[model samples]
Target: MLAAATAAVLLLFLVALVMMAAAAFAFAVLMLMAVP
Candidate 1:
């Protein structure tokens, strides 16, 4: 029971990290395109 709860929390954290990474990447691409 505790292990399952921990796993679920970890999974959510990983998903949030991935989403943040993707957003940063997309923002970088847009900035690069705007520069020139």
Candidate 2:
């Protein structure tokens, strides 16, 4: 039970990290387009 809980938490963390990275990448693209 403890292992399952830990796995769930780790999975959630990884998903959040991926989402943040994708957001950053998109923001960078937008900034580059706006510059010129």
Candidate 3:
């Protein structure tokens, strides 16, 4: 049971990390477009 809970937490953390990375990438693209 403990292992399962830990796994769930890890999965959530990974998803959050990916989302943050994607958001950062999108923001960078938008900034580039606006500047040029």
| Per-residue accuracy of model 2 over 1-36 as CA lDDT, tens digit each | 999999999999999999999999999999999998
lDDT per residue, candidate 3, 1-36, as tens digits?
Answer: 999999999999999999999999999999999996
lDDT of 2: 1.00
Candidate 3, pairs of clashing residues: none
- Can you give the TM-score per candidate against the true fold? 0.98, 0.98, 0.96
- Winner on lDDT between 1 and 3 is 1
All candidates in order of TM-score, best leading: 2, 1, 3
RMSD of each: 0.3, 0.2, 0.4
- Candidate 1 per-residue lDDT, tens place, 1-36, comes to 999999999999999999999999999999999998
Residue 11 lDDT in candidate 3 = 100
Model 3 TM-score relative to the real fold: 0.96
